[model samples]
Target: MTDIALVRVTFDTAAEADRIARHAIGERLAACVNIDRPCTSIFRWRDVVETAEEVTATFKTTITLASALAERIAALHRYDQPVIESWPVAVDTAVAQWIDDATHA
Candidate 1:
């Protein structure tokens, strides 16, 4: 396993996603953020099933910075229970190098 992870989060709106993305990149908390808009999310909230249109943001960063990055995203996100998930990235040398460069850039 690598010492890095790809963080996935969802926002209620494109505006919110944009804000979080800008803040993360601007602060060097993440090297890059990929935003997928107008996604339909289905989940349970407050003991009720809910469906909403949302934007998904995938943030690339090192595991050492994941906690801080997650906190920053939570602070900026509007949802009371925002979706924040991180997973390891396993790939070849070239892709790994690229991720390192991007996260440190």
Candidate 2:
């Protein structure tokens, strides 16, 4: 186990994903952000199952920074409710250290 977190978010467009990624990384809220290929998402919204093409945004940051990072993302996100999830990462010793150092203000 490491003190690092991998946060994932989905956006309606590649442009929106890139905007958040750039801000998060530039502000040091995230060590890195990877925008994945577009995929289809199917889920219930307003009592109906809806499907849409979405882009996945992955963020690498420390656990300590995870909440703030999510909040910041939510603030900038356009959706009424954005999907922001974080989980602890099992990282190598050096990589964990790198995450901690890089995410520190």
Candidate 3:
């Protein structure tokens, strides 16, 4: 069975996002990566509240590869605590097959 998943991550800069995306593709961790424009993120770090501009990237991969993709992203990320999440998505059969074919566990 083919299962599709989306791995979402945020980076400090666009370059970082691109770098990670390239690495993921090269390593067969993700089928495709969509890099979004800069977005403002607000959160609390430690004892203080903070806000910063970040670039978000969504990795199209298979359910089997989602964990490995997230691990790779964390290893290559520069942030002390990077936002890396994976969610199962219901996609068309064709898309699910495509992702499964592209991603390697």
Clashing pairs in 1: none
Best-to-worst ranking by lDDT: 2, 3, 1
Candidate-wise lDDT, in order: 0.83, 0.92, 0.91
Per-prediction tally of clashes: 0, 0, 0
Q: What TM-score would each prediction reach against the true structure? A: 0.85, 0.94, 0.94
For model 1, residues 2-104, the per-residue Cα lDDT tens digits are: 4567899988888888898899888878888899868898988889999988889899887778888999999988988787998877666666666667667
Q: List the residue pairs that clash in candidate 3.
A: none
**Candidate 2 residue pairs in clash (backbone atoms < 3 Å):** none
Q: Give one digit per residue, the lDDT tens place, for model 2 in 1-105.
A: 566899999999999999999999888899889999999999999999999999999999988899999999999999999989999878888898887777776
Instruction: Compose the digit string of candidate 3's lDDT tens values, residues 27-82.
Output: 99899999999999999999899999999999999888899889999999999989
Give residue 55's error in model 2 in angstroms: 0.1
Mark the regions of model 2 whose C-alpha exceeds 4 Å error after superposition. Answer: none
Number of clashes found in candidate 3: 0
